[model samples]
Structure formats: C-alpha cells, structure tokens
Target: MKAFIVYCHPSENSFTRHIRDAFIQGVTDAGHECVISDLYRMDFQADMTEAEYLRDAHYRTTPDVAADVRAEQEKINASDAIVFIYPVFWSEAPAKLVGWFDRVWSYGFAYGDRTMKTLNKGLILCSAGNPIDYLEETGILDSMKKVMLGDRLTGRVKQAEFVVFDSTSRENPLREENWDKNLKAVYEKGKSLFAAK
Candidate 1:
C-alpha cells in the first residue's frame, strides 16, 4: 500500500523524531511505499493570511498552493493508507501541521458536499511528552477526538488510529525496544484495518 506520513516535529533529535522514524520504518518494512511531509524542514507557514482566506473564498487557487494541494491530494487519493506523525504541543498539533490542514486540506479538496459520502483511509501517529493515562484523564484525548475526528478529520478518513507515548518519564523510556514495540503496535493496527476490506 502507498502511505503518506506527515511529520511535524521541529527538532531532529527529539523523541518525537524517534517515534516518527519507527513508525515510518514499520510501514516500509510492511512493504508499503512511504511519502513523508516534513513540515519543519519544509518551513511551512501556519497562519492563514487574509489573502489566503480570500482565495479560499473565491476559489482562486495559488499556483504553489495548487501544486502542493495537488500533490497532497494525489498522495491521499492514490494511497491505500495514510499516517500523521507529530508531537502534541499545548495538547494540539504543531503550528505547521495545523497549517497543513488549512492549506492542503482546503475546501473542495479534503471536504465538501461530496465528502459526507466518502472518506479516505488513514492513521495518526502522535507522540507526546505526557503519559497516555494522563492525557486521557485530562481530556486531551477528548479534545483530539473533537478536533481530529469529530471535526475536520471526520468523514475525511474512513479509519484512523491514534498512537500516544509517554516521553516525560523520569527514566528515559524511549529506548530502542520500546520504540520497536510502539511502532509494531501501530503497524499491526494499520495492517488489520487495511486488510479488512
């Protein structure tokens, strides 16, 4: 299967990077083609401008936005699966990833009247500093459900899996083995979903 991985970490050596790499490797090892969108390396702009909003309003697509939107759409359209890798900042995705949603997943592209009938197939790989239980107990998961699932991401993807890791452990828990296990679980989940049809 073809897969797109949107990575949104700012630091190269961060735990987020490790988790992202592990997930990528898992998908690749499963014999899937991987397309990565490294937002930080690309220096993607997050804030939507009045001009941009106007373009969206008028459907005057920029050549650059048009090309990128096409590329992203192509990946989504061609792929049998999709993945998002990022670190949670303030309980949400980074500015660049959010910007990606604004720019790439524009109206008529990711959603429109036709979208209520069809959705893409994909998964999400998110690594956070806090523990999974903490995030769940504190309503972070609920917020994500509302934003990524209940809101924009809803009806866009037929299926999605959320992977959260505890990075703030006093003892470094992001060891090689732990990473392997984490990524394996994600891969297994994807495999099950992809093979269901």
Candidate 2:
C-alpha cells in the first residue's frame, strides 16, 4: 500500500515538522511507499485564480485544471491512503491547506463525475496551542472534525480521522512534556496506515 502525506508548515523548526518526520519514518519502516507534498517548501499556489473561480462557481467541468492541481489529484489517485499534517490556526487548518481544497477539489475531479479514487483512509495530524480539553469545551474540536471529516474529506475517502496534538504553544510546558509521547503515537498510526480496517 502507498500513503500520500500533505504537510503544511512555514517553518522547519517546528513540532509539526517533527510529527511529520516521525510519521514518515514509521510509514517507510512499515515497508509502504510514501509521498510527501511539503506545501510551504513547494511554494504551492494556494490561491484560486479568476478562471478557476469561474469554472468552479459555475460547475463547469470541461476546462482543464491547472498543472499543480492536476498533480495533487494524481497523487490522490495513486495512493491507498491520505494524511494531512499541519498545525491548527484559528480553530482551522492553515489557509494554504484550505486553498488546496478550493483548487484541487475541482468540479470535474472531486465532484460531478469525478475521477479521483476512493482511498482506504484519511488522517489528520495537527498541533494546537490550547489544551484538548479547552478546545473541546469551546466546541472547537467538534467544529474542526465536522469541517475536516464531515465536509472536506467526506465521500472522498472511505474512512476519515482528525487528530490534534494540543497544548503545543511555546509557553506551554506540556508542549515539551507530551512531545515524545505524541510523536510515538502518531508514528504508530503511520505504521498502521495500511493495516486491515
């Protein structure tokens, strides 16, 4: 089985990057092929142009998608599973990821007689500034799940998951304390990416 990871982060010196590295290592160790799209490193064009907006808004399927968008879609079709790794920003994924959806999930491919394949799983690994309990209490957790799993990844993936590594703010001591533990768990998660469901 193959896994495709979409990693988004502006800085290399980040816990999120650590999560990504550990997860990738685990996947490779499990003997499954892995492909990574580091959005920031690639300087991916996240914003939708006027032509793209017009094509999507009107639900037109004839126009050809941009090369970059086609490349992402190709990756999705090639993999058995998909993973998204990033940090939570304003109770949501970074804007780059959001825009990825806007452009990549085009009408012809993601909807309206799409060619994208149905994957075995979809997983989200995100770091948060606040604690998980606080996020749950504030309803941020559920909202994030609904948007990511219920909406964005819905129908596209056979299974979907949203994971949050909370209390990762620089000021929080738990960031350091839980760092190893969280990475261990996510690495295991990666190892099982192709395990029987």
Q: Superposing every Cα of model 2 onto the true structure, what RMSD results?
A: 0.7
Best by TM-score: 2
- What lDDT score belongs to each candidate, Candidate 1 first? 0.69, 0.93
Model 2 C-alpha lDDT per residue in residues 90-136, reported as the tens digit of each score: 99999999999999999989898888888889999999999999999
- TM-score of the candidate numbered 2? 0.98
- By summed lDDT, the worst window of 10 consecutive residues in model 1 runs over 111-120
Off by over 4 Å in 1: 57-65, 113-120, 168-180, 187-193
> Against the true structure, whose lDDT is highest?
2
TM-score of each: 0.81, 0.98
